[model samples]
Target: DARVTQTPRHKVTEMGQEVTMRCQPILGHNTVFWYRQTMMQGLELLAYFRNRAPLDDSGMPKDRFSAEMPDATLATLKIQPSEPRDSAVYFCASGLAPRGSGEQYFGPGTRLTVT
Candidate 1:
């Protein structure tokens, strides 16, 4: 019964508030991904990692978004001084796809609302 779990499933914050979200990836999966979905941008990859090591984060806004894997099963994404434009659903996914093609099992996303 392994699956990714996310905390604070829903969040509402005033503009400029710092927000942190946590994810517990499915055991045995080495590759983790962070994604964001908004009305304008359909699900977009923000970061990708293998063995707790970051492989790519080009899609993430360098100034405000950060993603990290501190341990095998734990990953986190943080936004400091979040803005209304940052309001969106953030998702964490994990799977074995190093060969380059595999479907990701997504956790229930964290819905953030900024005003």
Candidate 2:
């Protein structure tokens, strides 16, 4: 049984610092997604990758948000020059099936707070 795992489930940092969050998607899954959730934005799709290739990232703020897949099971999301508004729960999800037909299994999430 494989499950998505996230690191640093809770993080508190001062403003303008770099933060890195990681995730391990389920095995045999090729599609990975990064999402941010907050009071203002219920669930914002930041980006996704298919077969380690970026599919779409139009929902992410290009200035400070970045996502990458270093390998098959590992994915990462990074925030630079962090701000208070950037504080939220970041989730990494993986699709067990095709990009459109699969249900996404989400990690526990990494809670980031910038003050």
Candidate 3:
């Protein structure tokens, strides 16, 4: 199975800045999941509306971050007023089914740093 690809491999920005990560899911996949990773908290789920787990804003800061699948092949995550604490590797997983359903393609990840 092919994997999703993230852009810009790395990003660095100051505090209070905004960061946006784009993910292109595998073709024909109807379900997409957003996630974040940091040394302090491992990997965490951000959002999944059409997913099976029915997870909604699981741990993401609703006021600052957004995850949406605007179209069938594209999904996006935007963080406004990004803080130093928000620095982490963001990625997405895509599959025909929802979270924990089975095989899901993982992205290479977009590294973000808010200085």
Candidate 4:
């Protein structure tokens, strides 16, 4: 069976550090999504891409956060000068398109904590 995977499932860092999270989407999937979950903001779609091209990233902080698909199987999220406010669980999900009715497969998210 195919499944999405993420690395460094948990991380704790001091403020002003840089954090990088990685994801491997399910094979053959055409779309990938990144999401952040926090107590205040709840679950927000940070970004998504179709066929490895970013579709939208308006929900992410352009200055400090970035999301990208470097190749067909890999997606990455990075935060420079990470702050306590940036602590949250980040998730990666993948799905096929055109059918538009199936559930997206989600990776076991990466949890980040900044002090």
How high is the CA lDDT of each candidate model?
0.91, 0.91, 0.80, 0.94
Q: State how far residue 13 of model 1 sits from its true place (Å).
A: 0.9
lDDT per residue for candidate 2 within 16-111, as digits (tens), equals 999999989889889999999999879999999988889999998889988899999889888898999999999999995453576899999999
Q: Candidate 2 — which residues are off by over 4 angstroms?
A: 99-101
Cα lDDT of model 3 by residue, 1-115, tens digit: 6778787689999898878888888877777788889999999988864532335776778889877777777778888989999989987888785344687778999999998
Shift in Å, residue 41, candidate 3: 0.7
lDDT of 3 at 115: 87
* Clash pairs detected, candidate 2: none
Task: Let me know the TM-score candidate 2 reaches against the reference structure.
Answer: 0.94
Superposed by TM-score, candidate 1 places the C-alpha of residue 47 at a distance from the truth, in angstroms, of 0.4
Candidate maximizing lDDT: 4
Runs in model 3 deviating more than 4 A are: 51-55, 98-101
* Candidate 1 accuracy as lDDT: 0.91
CA deviation > 4 Å runs, candidate 4 = 100-102
Candidate 2 at residue 63, lDDT? 98
lDDT assessment of candidate 4? 0.94
- Per-residue lDDT value at 25 in model 2: 89
Which tens-of-lDDT digit does each residue in 9-107 have in candidate 1? 999999999999999888888899999999998999999899999999999998998888989879999999899999999999999866746878899
Better of 1 and 2 by TM-score: 2
TM-score of each: 0.93, 0.94, 0.87, 0.95
The numbered model that scores best in TM-score is: 4
